[model samples]
Each structure stands twice: as C-alpha cells, then as structure tokens.
Target: MTKYQLFKKLPLFAYVNKIHVRYNPGGPNTETCRKLMLMLLDPKTFTKHPYLTFTYELLSFNERPEVFLTLVPQVPFRFHADTCTLDDIHRAIDADQYKAHCDYLKRRSIESKYVQEE
Candidate 1:
C-alpha cells in the first residue's frame, strides 16, 4: 500500500498509556516507522487519545526501526516497522486494546459483585 493510505483514522487508544518509537530518518526502509509516528502525532489522534504520552527517537542510519506501546497495566508491546505494514501495526494495537478493555470490564464486574455482597 502507498504511504498515504496509512494516514487514515486510527482506532481508539483508550488502554494505551505511552507510545515510544525509534526510527532512522535516513534509512530507506524506515518509511513505515516514520509514517506511523506521523499518524500518532496528528491532531485528530491527540484529540481521540488525550491522556496518552508519545515519545520518539531518531536513530542512526544503521539501527533498526521499532515501535513500543505501553498499555494501561504496564504491559510493553514491541513491533518491528521495517518488516510490517502500517495496517499490521494498527491491527495488533486494536486487538490488544480490545483485550485490555474486556479485562477491565471483567475486573470491574468482580469488584462490583464483592461490593454488592458487602
């Protein structure tokens, strides 16, 4: 897919706490990583995820490009950008966010049940 195709709206990052990206600007294969970072920095993305923190590093030309996501429960997920498409990264984050939401709802239900019992 073309790089512009990856600029579409991103899924809600409700469960994500922090995003860290490492990419080499001069590297020919780091286009995906650069595009991903741009998407994260978009105004619409910021509006959708107000509480998220974003940090990025420009690596040397010899280094690999990677993205790291820190979930609400302090879970760390890593993705290699050079070998994956933007869609792949989005799908993985979407799946993890869904799981986190489900886990949150489950915990809340259990807590409410105990409170009702008390």
Candidate 2:
C-alpha cells in the first residue's frame, strides 16, 4: 500500500461498553465501517461547571484474549518479542486501538471529576 493510502481515511467506528452498544454511526449500503472522527468537547452539565469529553470508533469481533491485554501493558505490561504483534493495532482487537480508546475515556473521567471538585 502506498504511504498515502495508509493515512487516507477510515470508514467506520463502533463503540461497545461492557458488551453493550454505547454508540454507533451506522453506515449505508452494506458498509459496516465508517471513517472515525474523534474530537474533545467540554460539555456543560448541570451538576458541574463542565466535563471533558471523548469518543471511540468501535467495531464487532468474536472473543479474543488479546482484547484486554492490548490495554494493559500501557505501563506495567510487556510481551516476548517473539510473540509481539509488531504494534499493529488491527492485527488483534488488542493493541494500540484499545489502549487509545480506554485512555481517552479514562482521561475524560478524571478531568470530569477534577472539574467537579473545583
């Protein structure tokens, strides 16, 4: 694939929370994927001054052990080089993609709480 092709654009995103659908932007005409666009928006909720926000582009997949593992070693985790997935987020449902998703949510939650405490 051309270098440009690698960064062209994505086609779909699905966000699942605890085995439940949290958000999905349905694609059309037999398309199951849509380009994922992510941005941070501070929401003005009644209880607090404002809340930091984030989102994920999720997808469906059969159960895979790699799922949670991908998000773990962000700090305290490591894998044998012989078994590494070469940092490819799509190789398994268990790589940077998951980490990115979880990190975004975590930061949002922490920021929201901090703002509330202010």
Candidate 3:
C-alpha cells in the first residue's frame, strides 16, 4: 500500500471497537467533557482492540502531554491532569495491562496456524 493509502487504511479493530474521547481544559464544556472523555477512553478495553481518539475542543492552548497510550498501546496512556484525576488515569492503565496481556495471547493463537504443505 502507498503511504497515503496506508494512512487511509482503517484497522478492523477501529471499526469493531471504538470510542470517542473529548476533553476541554476549561470553559463551558470543561466538566462534562473531561468526565465523558475519560470514561469513553478508559484503557480497560485495551484487549478489545479499539481505535480511540483524544480530541481537544478548545483553541486556547498549551502543549498537551504526550499521551503515549493513545498512540502506542505498548506504553501507558496518560490522561491530561487538567481534565482528569490521577487515580482515574492510573486505573485505566492498570486495566489496559490485563487487556494487553490477553491480546498477546490472542495474537499468538492466530499466528499459530500450521499450514500443511501439499
């Protein structure tokens, strides 16, 4: 696949399992956005293989922390402090660890197919 094509390619998991995460540091939607986004993107579903997106609703800006989890499941995903509590974020990461473990098993099983030679 071409680079652009690859970019366009949507992982099956993305469609099968998906969540919308929205967060705003401050303003009218701040409170609701933070809670809702955290719930939706909770890492508990890591094994489920979902494409999660974290969106910033406000234009007023500061450099957001590197959300490694949102981009790379191998690393723990960080929830923005301004928008979420530390405990909440940690719990999600804890849950993700279990799910990631399970995912490893599932992948091994699928890859274990022994193709017989004719």
Candidate that would win on lDDT = 1
Give, for candidate 2, the lowest lDDT window spanning 10 residues: 30-39
lDDT of 2: 0.30
RMSD to truth, every model: 6.9, 18.2, 11.3
Each prediction's TM-score versus the true structure: 0.72, 0.21, 0.27
Ranking by lDDT: 1, 3, 2
Tens-place lDDT digits, model 1, residues 4-28: 6643443646788998889988787
Query: Which lDDT tens digits does candidate 2 get at residues 4-111?
Result: 564432211212221111223442221211211221122322124122223333443421111122132332232222233323323443444456556667767955
Q: Which ten residues in a row are the worst by lDDT in model 3? A: 9-18
Model 2 TM-score, 2 decimals: 0.21
Model 1 clash pairs are: none
Q: Specify the poorest-scoring 10-residue window by lDDT in model 1.
A: 1-10
Candidate 2 regions off by >4 Å? 1-89, 92-94, 110-116
Q: Ranking by TM-score, best first?
A: 1, 3, 2
Q: lDDT at 90 for candidate 2?
A: 33
Please provide, for model 3 over 1-118, each residue's C-alpha lDDT reduced to its tens digit, 9 standing for 90 to 100.
6545532323322322223333435544345446545555568645555455444444345444222234235453445544555345445555555565456566667454443435
